[model samples]
Target: MSAPDERETLATSLYAHVLALRAAAPDAPLPPGGLPLPRGARPPRDGAPGPRAREAWPAVTTLVRSALADADPVRAALALERELSAAGIRDRHVYAAVAALPPPEEARDRARALARALTRTGTTVTAVAAGLGLLVPLGEPEDVPYLRALGLLEGLGDRAARALAPLDRKAAAVAWLVRERSDALRPLVDALVRGDEQAARALLTGLSTTPRDLGRRQARYIAEAVGLTALLRDGPGLLVPAFGLLARMSEGPEAEIRAYDEALTLYETVADRARELPPLLGHRARLVTLVQELDSGDARLLPWPPGRRRAVLTALLTAVGEPENLSDPAASADWRRAEWVHRTARHLAAVTTAVEAGGRRAGAAGVPPTSRLRIEVAVGDLGEPTGVETRLLVDGRPLVPSVFGSGVGEPPETVLLNGALRAGPQPTEVRLAEAICTEGCCGALYVTVRRDGPHVVWDGWRRPGAPPGLPQAPAYRFDADAYDREVSRAERDLGWAWPARRTAWLIAEGLRERPGILARWGLRRGWISTDFHRPDVTVITFLGPPLRPDGTPDAEAATRQFLRHLPDDGRPPRERAAEALRRLAEEDPRRHPEPGE
Candidate 1:
């Protein structure tokens, strides 16, 4: 046979011996199957065991089983001991099985005798006997210390606690004594914060039973020491009580408010806080939500107390008005200005109901509407050439005389009006109004007109070099007519089926090119697209109408000139020729002429 085949045969023989030994010791369970026997089980291939020794395995199994079945474990153990001594069964397979039997009362005497014999014989049988001796329960903590020192905790598990209960109880008592002696139990505190959940829970439960002030302080220290502030911010649920403890520890109104604000900054779920807090403090929850809305440019202001409302509005206007605040010129242009104004107006509208309620309350004592009314106007933009005009109209006629100015290296004009006769504040009895604008010419205008008390004010503002001529009437009247004409031309240029769709498409497209346009219209991007369909394609559809009333393009008609090539295939010709165009416009009236044409 080849050398490889010889090795395989020897390994097989060793495995069979291990199995035979396992069968002999019926009381002891075998090790997990499929393990190869140790080196001692096989001799050198050149000096293989004789056939007679191989055949002796079955008789060995029978003898070992008979010896273990003896009534006294001492007798059984001694019998196996004698077999080990006489037969020289050194394989772990034989020794492990003998070790597994429960030790008899005289097991110690028998084990010592075997140990001495094995020692004299210079073999490992004594080591195996000692290991079996240790397995007998001695009920001593000293033995456990050896296990513990070796970090064999995994092997002991709950067994260690039961076996050394007195030692464990003593350890707990000592820990408590340490905590009592030192005010700063740094080790305990560190363990609580970084220990396993069970250990931390046990420590925290003990700590909580301490005096209230000390407990609260300790909890706060642990919370801070663990770097839990950011974690609390992300998940306030875990630290809700911790925040309450912090509040309890804080002193004075400012300190309390600072703590509350810090905690509030960590969580957006203020509704729960609102529900939990007293009514007066519940308002702060709403305020937080309102402030978030404002910061995000929601254009939905809260109708709070005048003082609060004024504070918020003032802050917003100041932010927009500051030269440094206007970050980009393109963002501060006319389009952005219109958006900012519109958003401000909507926000103002949301708060109008509350303002009106407050006004009624002020008028409770029969105060007449004739009280002096004041209107304040503030304009903000880049430091470029910009101007404003104020016009006050009363009873449908001009009230404040129209005034405009330009900046030619001079400061932009700021005007304050009183009851003086610059076209006397049109009497309040007839209906007062106001309009403001950019420049004196008032040819190009951004105007705001409002009726304040019994007088009227009309105002407009423009960039420095706006058109010079001011029409005799309000600019909007003329602009309205011009606007209509442009709309008509745009509709005709783009073959729109209805003016509304055309308008919607135009607005949607304009907003897409300039997102700020939606803010000016007091609409959201979602609302714009929701109200219109295929806005881009619709723009193309309207740019050139394809349908004729009779469902045929009037090729010979002058009025329908723009409809000649309404549906162009969106491709270059070389790749697909005119085939794509022909296919796309097969049913299109503009592409298909009358049958006889």
Candidate 2:
């Protein structure tokens, strides 16, 4: 078999092994499935009892089932000791034994009662801890106090106790613990962050011994931390696993809000530095869904007024910019680049959808609108030699004011919401919003949909814009219309190859524009197209639209993963491409195998 095929086979096998290990010891910073590692390396177990734990499952399961049912506490204790001893387990690992046994299939109320009893006694046995954790997935409401009580039981000190005091919510407490316990938990987070898969097993096993929900929350937070860490990590291998956990945990409003904060942090961290990593793209894709969720009115922010939250949300979204769709000149300020046109256009679509829904609500209000109820973006985030300016007006009033800025301008969260969303509601106008604020910074996206149902929808209120505002940013500005026109022309001219041509432009235009030789070389190779089946390595990246309407990689998508390309070179594909380009820069064009450059 070819060397590439061998690498693919090895990676696939290693991935399977790592998955099994992750299942067995979830709290460890075990490697995700896609990490490319050297030969014969095993993921560290952090003193985990692999074979011993495996052997103890059946025996421990029987003991736990009996112990859970036995009226005699002494008999249950003895049964646990005898079975655990026979299976080569010890005191520290008693949690693993109880964890191995599934939560009872029925009698959920009884299970909760049993869990509460275990908590009251503050049992040091690992099984009790394991029992406490299983309650969450087994239909327990996951109380903050219970988690705090468990932490105290496990010798979790004053910090953990103090952190859990204010919040009754599970996710909020978890987020806090992620910050406070960075010393103890940072290892697993770091391991996943580096894709090292080292002695994370012990950390993971420690979590697993009786802590499913917190363990899962740790995993989710680890993914978030890793994604933020990816901004400087040189590659995006950690992103897929991180975003996957985020997507899974984001089932409700509180969870979604926490996740949105994480996503925004991730984007703000890496928006300018590393744009093409798969995980970064994945994170962006997730942001679209998250914003959509906030706009959908599933979670009502009862405390905030209508236009207030939506205005903030719109600012954040527009200022943050989309992953695949940034205009040529600018990104956001926190991202160190600002974009307005396409960004505002995106918000326009979201608000228009909400407006249509609001119009339905208007029908209930006995006031029907004559308009077709679609939004029109009269002016986009336009960039020019003179200055940067853009707008999103609703029914002749501003959804957001003209956005144009450069270098470091005003606070971005304020810019997108400057003097907008204040118009009187049309017969069909309905706006829904959720405001998020922290450390004196606040923002949110607003959708104009009818308050059709008695849900927590609000009307766009007349409010003055907040300031400490940003001026026009021209250095990072591009004439978005011109850029789009060029892309459209390429589509008209080349059809399927437009993606390739567009990629070539990115490689040539964007990369070369960087102040480095590596960029120029890589772009040349992209235009040359002499190495489609390049051996050893080829960097796989994507450009243009990410998903089809059906939510698959669009026709233009050609990522290494989507294209069935193999990983042969030990280095990352991006690194490999850079090396290849460096080599090509030295080679003579006359010696080329085949070339169009």
Candidate 3:
């Protein structure tokens, strides 16, 4: 085929892949490190084009027309640099001006000639980058070597890859660049998804050794590409890197692993391979890390059903806990040993104890082997309607929206930790995701959390007063010890803590558990709400009151107290929260109600 025809064929394939991805997930952002959607003609954001740019547009067009009309490589290269500087216009705008002109059949040869000359001799890095950009619409197979050579220069790979995006041999050129520059993984993905097994292997090798900071930036895109699965079937040479990449993908966010279609299959493969293969340093630590994540409510593993998660965990334990593996003197020298090996052993032992205590098999107790619960605070986007709330992730999926209808957010962390997960022997009904109404009439979903022998179970889904029907959710049974570890871990995670949220939760907890604090002010019922003005400062509002003659809450008569500004103030959140609660308990409403109240 002609070079132009081959370029067109490659471009069509890439376009088809992008369309397939969009069809599969219309709402998701395109994976980073993948083919970028066309950015179109907007000027760069860092600075607007100078006024001289608009004035120079006609001159820029005449220059491009004359250059293409002449079809002389030497003159075209000289005119490109001279005219662009003289016109005082940007290269992108020049490219746009050139693309706008009607192309004659002869224009292809002329344009390619200019593209070659400009790319070959362009003086500045910026000029070379701009020359490559021109080839996006006009690049052909023969231009591949020049693109590859230019791409070898530092920070030029992305631009070279962009020009190569529509050309045949794109995978080979991109794969080569990636081996030299890992940052090129972003564009390498564009080539990998079109059934290029070579590019897939190249990507795995780059991801396996890339620095952690860069690996994280590339993780989600690595997960999105469909080609990596082929490496699993290739051989053990790639398996080690595959394991390394999986460990990285498991970090940061649930979305990274969730985006990967083959996650479960890969986990299963890793587990199966662990029992058969001799332990290597990479395999030992990476497998242990995967298992540790699986144990501590990694979100996906704990909730995985039919015992696949349990089986994977068991296989990992057998692999990592082998006497020969642990006895190695170098074990202590491994940096990740303390992080993964010790923790994994403890968790796996606990899981084993729980499973064995239930009976010979985990199923005997009606609980899966590695099942655990996670109470995560999901902070909605600022200015969005969704507010901060503690949510339940059964395994890795959200339980709130699935059970309660869509219009709900949970109570503060204090309310949930105090009432549900840590509730005593008698089942406790905790207020879960509720309607967003201010008056509190729309009602909320409640779950009964109770202990059943070796398991902690969440059952008895109910939505009282505001609605008659509730969505069906299974009774989640988690091993008691694993459940406790998760709850304790969440409580210690002050990562989510801020002065305002802490104060509001403390006040809310005080009111809910100790009604006398509110009753002392002649207020029988109260509601707690917090507005975080910033990360450090919050406004905790207590609303409730003296009722009207009709026995309904009279808004005008209600006690509206604002603990105006609770700043970080160099105090521990607990200390600050306690002081605010004490002040609320001591203040006399009749003598010192809020000014309007």
Candidate 4:
């Protein structure tokens, strides 16, 4: 193919993905002409220049190549830099150029330069957002200082949010956090400041996947920020982050203090904001007392009820037995705290039971509940996709997004069923050419859905089972109701078992084995508060004895196994505990491959 034709071919291929995104997420704000969907929102509306148009495809390609093409690449690079500065990053053409530029020595150099220049120059929100798209994926740790500045900005205000709405600031922040892997608080704070659509999704991905390790105080600070985001929204923010904070604060010793502080702050902010809003989001009179009780460190009536308040306290107690009483004797103090927890667990369990019953009735009502939805696509073997995903939920249906354009064949490992990428309208058919991983391998996840009168039947989307994991994605089946059903199951299951080590292991096993049914429970906000392996996995010292093939634990064997996973801290365990742990960790396969064998 000629150079223009080759560029056209690639652009055409990219355009197809864009169209698929448009078709799938009809509700998104489509942009004008052939521009890359800014932050995965807005492609041109119908009757506008579609991607197939001779004029449209080539223009984007021309813009991309012009910025990179060169006989002496550096000269062209300098010229592009001048042009970018002269025209200003705010120019619409800048975004098209930035989003489309093919990676090359010159492109990489230019992107870094541009990110730095744009950051220093203070571009418009759209320009800054578009600049982030280009830089986050390709920019290095050095370029972080500039991007970090953008991430640190507070008070974007409603107007700025609306202005950047087309750019999908939420997704951009998340994409930056995920791809850049910057540990700086700026990024998390930025995402929260903008009130990310699915704040928890971005926050969690960054927290878990980023190479950077964050401290408990910083984590607590983030917890406060997430709660602050919710408070700012008053009536409705992404509830996940707010709830996710409860989970975070519930973890670690003295973490409850952080949780209580965040909740109190949130409660105060919410009370103030609610007064400003049209009407309160649902009465939380009991919630006030819950916060007060926690703040007071009083173990009195425990006035919290069946909602957020109960969950928060349950998670806190579950993390660290109970608050200490300064008046109590030092040695016997542990016993008293344990006794308090024993009592609290019963009350919390009762509350959870009540909530579960109510949730079941609500869920059993059968109609699919109306709510925002986001789609996350996983790539690489990182257990999640890079920001190589987008949310284009049109009328509650996720489209295979254009964000996957750059990752067409990466063999999407998993498509996270949540995260509101941007606000848009809905369309009928969900036409996607994507990959899906199955059974720890990969295959294609191509599907074309159209309505069959009253409902969408995947009869149009009969994707076969895919090979699992990376490289080649398998065709996997999807049930839209899976999220709801899984949550219901988790609630019932969690309620059945108290906060025991066994409960955590079962939850993990449930996720790994029956992912379709219970996977979300492990990762989603309302589910497990701590990351999958936290206190529980460490509680491996707590892992019970050997199990029968039927999977029932053998108490005798469990004690032995517990000792095995447990590392000997400087201090020693009880003699029996030490023996069990040592035996479990050091069991000789030659002597014990099969106890009776």
lDDT per model vs. reference? 0.31, 0.35, 0.55, 0.35
- Candidate 1 TM-score over all chains jointly: 0.17
Residues 1-597 of candidate 3: C-alpha lDDT, one tens digit per residue:
788865454333222334545566654422443334222212233564543546656776676667777757767767666666554576555555554554467687777778777777665333454467568678888887677555544445566666765574333344233433344554444455344666666656655432333453255345434344555765666566566566666532222464455677777776777665555554555565566456442324333667777778778777775333345545654432333344445545554566547524443221233344655554432221224666566764557555554334465464445635674789887666676562167667778888899888888977765554666778888888888766665565544444456666676666678878766655543444454324435555544554556555566764544334566566766788778668768974434434555
Query: Model 2 misses residue 359 by how many Å?
Result: 15
Clash number for candidate 1: 42
User: By TM-score, how accurate is candidate 3?
Assistant: 0.38
lDDT of 4: 0.35
Model 4 Cα displacement at 44 (Å)? 20
Q: Highest lDDT among the candidates is held by which one?
A: 3
Stretches of candidate 2 exceeding 4 Å from the true structure: 1-55, 89-125, 137-147, 152-180, 183-336, 340-597
Give the Å shift of residue 104 in candidate 4. Answer: 2.8
Q: Report how far residue 120 has shifted in candidate 1, in Å.
A: 49
Ranking by TM-score: 3, 2, 4, 1
Question: Between prediction 1 and prediction 2, which has the larger lDDT?
Answer: 2
Ranking by lDDT: 3, 2, 4, 1
TM values, all candidates: 0.17, 0.32, 0.38, 0.26
Between candidates 1 and 3, name the one with more favorable lDDT.
3
Question: Candidate 2's residue-wise lDDT over 382-494, tens digit each?
Answer: 12111111222223222232221111111211222222222223323312222222212333233332223222223343222323353331211123333233223222322
